[model samples]
Target: MDELDAWFPYETYRPYQREMLELAATCARNGGIAMIDAPTGSGKSSIVSALLAERAGKKVIVAVRTISQLTTFIRELELVRSRKRTLAYSYLIGKRSLCPLSGGGDVYRRCEGVKAVSTSLMRERAGTGQLVPSRDPVIIRQMKKLDTQHPIICPYFIKSRVFTGGDGNALRMLPSTTLRNRADRITRERVLPHELREMGAGICPYEMLLLAAQKSDVVVVNYHHLFDDEIRTQLYGSLGIEPHEVHLLIDEAHNCGEVMQGVMNTAISGPALLQAEREILGLRRQLKQAVAVTQIIRNIGDFMEGLRNSHEAEDWFDPSIFDRIVVRGSLYRDLSEVVDDLMQISEHIREKNRAAGEYATTAVEVLTAFMVRLTCSAPDPAFLTVFRRDGDEIVLEVRNIDPSGRLQELARSHHCCILISGTLSPIESFRRYYFGELDVMTKTLPNIFPPSNRMVLCAGDITTAFSMRQNRENTDRIARYITTFASLAGNLAVYFPSYQILETYAGILEGRLSSRNLIVEPKDARDAGDLLKTFLSLPARGSSGILFAVCGGKWSEGLDYRGDLLAGAMVVGLPLAPFNRVRQMTIDYYRHKFGSDGEFISYTLPALNRAEQAIGRVLRAPEDRGMLVFGEKRFLEPRVRSGLPSWIRDEMAECSIDSFAAAVKKWK
Candidate 1:
């Protein structure tokens, strides 16, 4: 606390801020791991940054969950550097975020051919942080000098040259350039942003960041950069850093566990398979080697098409049919052989496209991934190897009902693994599910925000029990209940259990509320960030807007709505599992893993976590005040209350709609 007190930006620490720093200090001294759960407003990022900055002879790597979330970390580090005088870090962007040449305009489409030629090479070698010469820089330079504008050539040339064992400048430049820095400005030394890497450093930013990691105190990255082992290995290899020398600081760590499971999960869609068959067909004219592999994928596509046709005819596809086919001993070996063959011929197929054939490469990747998943050992006693149905597509996923084995492997390799988030309740349950017997410290800070500043109201009349989901009367009642608080003078959000509920109630809301005042999140909107941005920008009377989004989606977690912009949140239903085959398998796995507490681990806890996240979106700062209403009769029931968070369960008020509305008005 004394060391951080000098550098922290706030006038005073939140009650838990000093305590969290002390815990972090203890973990550092003992060389052990710690899991700390502080609410959203408790300044987790700041304290983590402060620890990294203040600690001596050690480096911290903070893996954030999203690129959009990276800004907060960077901004916090800047604050610490202003006074702490120990901020040495870099923003490491991925190919998706860093490679400007791979995206945008017609030059981007033309760049795709070179990208395909380079993709295979990138898969082979990590850059040595040195340049070799090729036409990539010249071509990119010409493209820039042409009738069109060019993206930064440094990043493109690095991959095209370095990947194939030849080289050019390895950094990409952008039109988002600025005047050159003065000698003092460049020499002053500060954290580097991805956009300015090429212009400021005159080196390949990606390679530069890796080299910089060896000398710097911290490397800030997104979760996928570490969650995926191959990518993680490339990072370690490039830096020559061992596991014991590095400590991981994971933000939004609850999602980190899910990300680990997702990494192991692989899927194949219908269009993707059909596209692979078409891409493979094009390879037939050039080489005879394509024939055997082409036949395998063709047969696979035919089988998939047959299933879809059967479903169209009978209204439902049988899970047993897919499961039986996937498990036959001979099937696994055949799929492995095909994957090997296809991987050999994939580059040739990609080359034939001539321009941008991302679709074809993507299709090949999908098939290879699913085939690879089929070959890997299943996690443990229970898991699914079957293809599941997702509206018009059959997704073949290697679902690991158990993720602890892989997570433990990662934890054991790192010097310290700290999983921090706002909603890591029942920390023991998280440890059981995510780490098995791995030794670690766990702590939770009491809610510093008072009951007077925030309120969680439970509805006594509404219930979204599975049995009543489809009933018109229930939907109508739920719709009416939302309008009660939504009509108030505040920016509000209503979260439903699923898109079906959101859409159904949204239609009912159409009659009561104007279309102009509603922002309904789609079940699978590609860009949710944009959707939220659009919602906040609309002309409102006084920061009083209304948005309806789904629980456990882009908006339900991670997003911070602080202040008057989001003054109230209404959660419509518990995020319950339907009586489906996958659900049954999940329950069976948990029952095997946790015995009696299995149900809570598998169902009740997950639902409450989502509900808790929704309620948390409103009260984001110390002075912030908001209303949180959980509008399901199940929420107020003894069985459900027994499992909820202490702050929520203890202060919740069960009230009639009229009385609740009056109280909210009075509080405002």
Candidate 2:
């Protein structure tokens, strides 16, 4: 047995951590993909870091699903470095996420609340400081500097100064009177030129990951960026690198299939079409007098009329008929024509009015973007769809559908690949859907905590469907059952399948439960946050209450109500998403592709995973005392129970929730 201090330096290895490290090291050595199924709080990051240390020179990309997860990973890396200082690391974000301040963008606007003492102090400090208008020549010089080396950073201060001045030489040419006025405005507003530049250049975390991946040894990003076709192509193809060269480590691997489906699916609506039509109309009105422009407008009007008559947007249109409607050829040629026409009309529409000229220029830029998005074909699997609005108009939506196969091809072209995750279970399913083969090696980590820490109870009587609605009699029975459990538990989070079910249960428990017991439902995200805050603030011991939440909701996943803060949970249904038009279409499409069983594989299974995630929220720490109760009877069936994890099944076998009240009373 290896002491925790030997390899981990943490004094002990949690069973799951040891297992995860073993699997990651094996995958790193063998150069194969591996999926790990381990619960949260299992020190997965530590295991991965150990694996990365062994593979010194190679780049590793860890793709997570949320900003919170990315932040945690970075913090964990920082901790690891503190313990072992041999690692070299840099955090990369998308080109757009780079600090505008660092890039020389005037980001002064973002520092509004921070008090600025005096301009003289700012001028004295040469290095990075919180001075409002730092006058240190070197710092000022660095702030003014602009280079293409950091493309993501925006020189917003430079841009703003030029924009406000109306010319590049505005600062130099300013008269003393005007200069004094500008200076006064700057001081009073506390607006620093350098600060404004920084604000504009600020990019999001997703963009940061993309940028970091290029140069950093380890890159952390959201799964959506790598899995989504449009984003993946932009990252790999544009970077001139094969996918396999960069290793991928997905943190929450279980959600990959569902995330892939979401990325591939696209939707178009009526209101969207009308908005696009308005833009087209504005463009047409701008060039009304030109012969070509007039003809194009007339043709578009005719097309809109035909679309209105048909009342269908999905019907295909002949490409030849619309070819003349769209301008093509070289980008320079398209820009030249638009500029020439605008110049000819400049005299008619007084250039003296700056706003008019600005509008025309802005329109030209918008048109340019539209043209590029329409013509670019370096990427593959591109498809175009059109829809019609109630107001006799047409809208077009273009997308790259199903980029997985292309991504796989890109991956195969690389020398080595590693796919690691904490929740990559039922490995065969992921292999079949993502890699199209089961050739990749698989591994599962042992549970980190003792089995007795958390208990799962399939309290198999809670039902909301018509046949088993909790009526007057059943409501009392259900309320009594929950009350009994709450008395024994510290904090309980009960999940209903829908808002209707939640409201129904809440009404039943109205007077029976104490006012101190906070009950939350899906009214809005803000409301949910408040409810969670109240629930967590309760004392760790003897904090008896009910937090009413919906299954597969915002509260279910990405939330931590661990330890004594959350003691028990009740799940009302299987969380099979209601069959709507879009879900039905998805089921039908997958069924046609793979068969009837495919729909369950595609839809039902994914929804069930979400329920599992919700239940997983309670049992966060090793010492956390928690029990999961499933209200739905269907969960007891072999088909549903078979898919559940072995640990969960063992917990369920102990005591079903149908006999919940008696069980709780006996335990108490």
Candidate 3:
């Protein structure tokens, strides 16, 4: 038997499962980066088995974007442990989910303040005769004295641990036996974040998970735990794990660039400046540098106002002009000096607020962080400074155009990195866009599901181009196509390029489709969940429904439409972003970096990916039969056609609206 057999939970291998396992094993043995473009239902979750087989002593960290994905791996690890009961695993999500304390503040900063006070009180009690400070009478009294609504110290953290009886030199701390027992139970059972929170009535769930992670062979975390620098540093430091000792696995690898960009981006708004100026003035007598900081804040506001007057919505702003305003308005000689003063004042205010049991983040701290990023990223061409109107306020933003440099740094810092996603088609484009010139291994697995179960059609007559969208003839054609598809037996979803397009077609077909239910995706996300619940119930009631949604919106991705729930889907057009100044600047930056292929790689590929994601909602299982329609003439172009997955390209039929109606009528 092969060594990997011990880790494999199931006795049978689906098509290409053994091959993917072996490739992952090899990648783990030889340290570097590897990208895998495996389709859904290819047993991508089982790749963790191969990593476990090869992990000699290093810790494995699997990062996911959402809670559902994290739960999927937790179940998979449980199966692996069924084969090897001694294998242990744990997971860590955001603090907002795990924390028991509630207040209007940044969770991380609030956690820091509470943990500091909790640890200090615990140590003082331990200095006396009380070894377990949580049970100490004096400590309990102090904690009870704090306001229940907004306590400065955390009761969960205090109750989560105990200290060894000794003096300062020989003192030590350990997880309470009760918390350790719960941690052990989590390794043995399928405990989700909410479940763990319930289980932790009196203990800190995060502390319990940390205790489990320290002894386990594998640890699961959210994407921010690995993508953000401060979070990564704090997580690694707590785990006592170093860079070389880490083996990283990133699921939904397609979101890597966007997530990294979010970490690097920073902004300050006009309203924020007003609040910061008020804060500085309130501290004028005590803060020595208050006058200089207040002037700088006012000048920055004026600078943003000037940019807003010159640009319509969003456009590039000169960083040199910003620096000149700051230095000329204040006593500081350079931008860095002003940033240092802001940082100092922000920290002072934070400490003062924490001492008063008010853990809210001040507006000045937000400006301080933005200025720091602006000063630090000015020389890098990948970072673009722009001003845009958001609602009623003008905001200045520093956006990171390309994430390849940060991705490269993250990949090289680890022992071995594996990024896997179901939608990473045209693997070469993604590799170039993610790693630049870095030597990275790549794989594109074949579609394991039978091709007979699904049919794809690309329109040859209709187009949703900007110029033709308003044409009465083109609008009627689109309405006719949707009304025809509404005659099908089950739920049909049509995704448009934007909400405006969706509303245009929806308005034309609102009362026209009385035979079937018409459900349109809401702009507000809080209302979307309830509407989705309504959409999913139509098949069970023996009723048919047609949904109008926009690509890249809430309903287009991260959803599971299983058998009969979604019988067919249509992507109305290429879901390109709105052509605006901000988008053009991003395209121009990429063109400079990637030469001729810049616009296609940066702009076109993402739109195609979003379209595929919407269509891929159908055919979730091998036995599931469904129809997919690409509702635009541009899909027939060679460049766009070639970028689709081979499975889609092979089964696709190019048709006009009349032919599409004929095909749907004849479809099984």
- Which is the better candidate, 2 or 3, if ranked by TM-score? 3
Candidate 3's residue-wise lDDT over 309-393, tens digit each? 6647777888998899867847988899999889999988999988766777889998998999999999998999988888768
Question: Between prediction 1 and prediction 3, which has the larger lDDT?
Answer: 3
True-structure RMSD, every candidate: 6.0, 11.0, 1.6
The 10 consecutive residues of candidate 1 with the worst lDDT sum are 174-183
lDDT of 2 by residue, 492-514 (tens): 77787778778876776767776
- In order, the Cα lDDT scores of the candidates are 0.67, 0.52, 0.86
lDDT at 330 for candidate 1? Answer: 32
TM-score of 2: 0.66
lDDT of 1 by residue, 235-331 (tens): 7776677767777788887776678888888777777877877766777877665666666665565557666544321122333454344434333
* Candidate 2 deviant stretches above 4 angstroms: 1-12, 16-19, 54-56, 93-153, 156-215, 228-242, 285-423, 466-481, 514-516, 540-545, 580-585, 588-597, 654-658
Candidate 2 — worst ten consecutive residues by lDDT sum? Answer: 109-118
TM-score for candidate 3: 0.97
Q: Where does candidate 1 clash, by residue pair?
A: 132-167, 132-168, 133-167, 152-173, 154-171, 154-172, 155-171, 155-172
Best by lDDT: 3
Ranking by TM-score: 3, 1, 2
